[model samples]
Target: MKIFELPQTNPLSANRTIPNVDSRGFHYKDFETMKPEDSKLGDAGFYVGIKATCVYHSQTERIALHFLDFNTRVLTMRTHYPYYEEERFAKKYLSKAPIWRKEVATIDIDILYENDDFELAQHGVSCKDKEEEFLTQKVVRRSARDHEFYAGINGTWEPVVKNYFARKEYDNYEFILKHIRKSNVLALNEEALIVSQLWKKRGLKRPMDSLLEPFARKIGTDKHHLFRLTCVAIFLGHLRLDHKYEFNLRTPLRLRPDGVYQFSRGVETAPWGF
Candidate 1:
């Protein structure tokens, strides 16, 4: 998971003040609070723009490059995807660093307001589980299973609407800032895709219908498609998912053809796995 590192000489800092702030006059906090902005600000105070390629394990895994503009706090992640021309251009021109940008996630950071008003929004991660419990709130509800399911836990769509599928979008906004803090770090947007694909392969359909379906109904998006994006954020966050690998107490043994026990290297030679 090699990520690009932010350069020491920030393109944002130039004739700037100590307390960095965006165009809206929102003063920047330390890396502890502001994460990458404080470190990447360098001397520019606040970054005006950022352009970096997001390469995963190899060149082919070069999915997209995040273009973050601090002035507007709008992370416009542009990739060579969805369009046939972009694909053909990538295949012919950017062969070594080929990428696809078919689908994109434009995150507005302003939504993550750390206020009490957005408390339900914070529970977006738990909406799916809650939806199931609501199904059986009343007896003999099988007659209106479809209606009851959508009615939700508290008999309204307010929770589903507010909670929706925002946790992922909110986290993505933070992830960009975290990775961009170091000018040279290569942010590998992995784990989530793999996990989501694993779920799809397993033929699980609850997450889409429960977690993302509500959002799609309200906003007119494909629930299944939206879940993939949500999974990425869920996998990225430490609280939700631990993408980092850890070694075991001791290397496990593997049986060879000759009946000899040999130390086993985990699949992909990763440090640990089941």
Candidate 2:
């Protein structure tokens, strides 16, 4: 099934406001209402915000419910967490506040997931492909507003974990069933998110110099070599992880100030078994 994204703002009604951390959000005081036994110490309980009714269209129409649980005190465009069983969440939290109950809304899953222009609509872009307007004023690029992460490029673990177990099935699925899967498809993966934030804050850019030029003759002109070296430098600059790593080879890699990677002879070769 394709990923479903709930509209951040309430498009159902004009007067409704989206419940976020800053607005009608779950508060630390609200957690006090839950019985101490039901709540754990030092555990930051979740916030149930925007709710949507998802209807699956097929031979037999199926209906499902989903909620966005924005963690307490976290503030970001992608702060909402996906949760199912809206009744369970309501029974636990919404009984106390009547006004907050207004945040819940209904939606069609097919309109959001299967539509061709859903990507453009979700970002609030207002432009039509008009042939008459050649010199139309460009207010902003759609790419700037679109930050949703897909699989593979952003180090998202959902697809990775899914692929690992998908190859084989066992009578005992218990090995993989116990883990809680928090759906985080709305935002970039943790690594890319951090990098993007750092890039904006620090004005970071990939240096366009090659340190592997000296070894280029030996290694030849493989693009992967340059990409690998660039990634190493990027990790060092953005992640604050400068620890030395040993590859399963005789050469030792080092980073140069120009953001290029250099390799030198190691003092000792790896053991044959290694």
Cand. 2 TM to true fold: 0.17
Model 2, 188-252: lDDT tens per residue?
Answer: 23333343233334323332233334333333544344333333223223222111432212233
* lDDT of all predictions: 0.27, 0.24
The reply for model 1, stretches above 4 Å from the true place, is 1-211, 218-220, 235-239, 242-274
Give the 10-residue window scoring lowest on summed lDDT in candidate 2.
155-164
Backbone clashes in candidate 2 total: 0
TM-score of each: 0.17, 0.17
Error of 1 at 149 (Å): 60
Instruction: Give the per-residue lDDT of model 1 (tens digit) for 123-195.
Output: 0111122244435545124324323322332221111211222233333434544534443211323433343
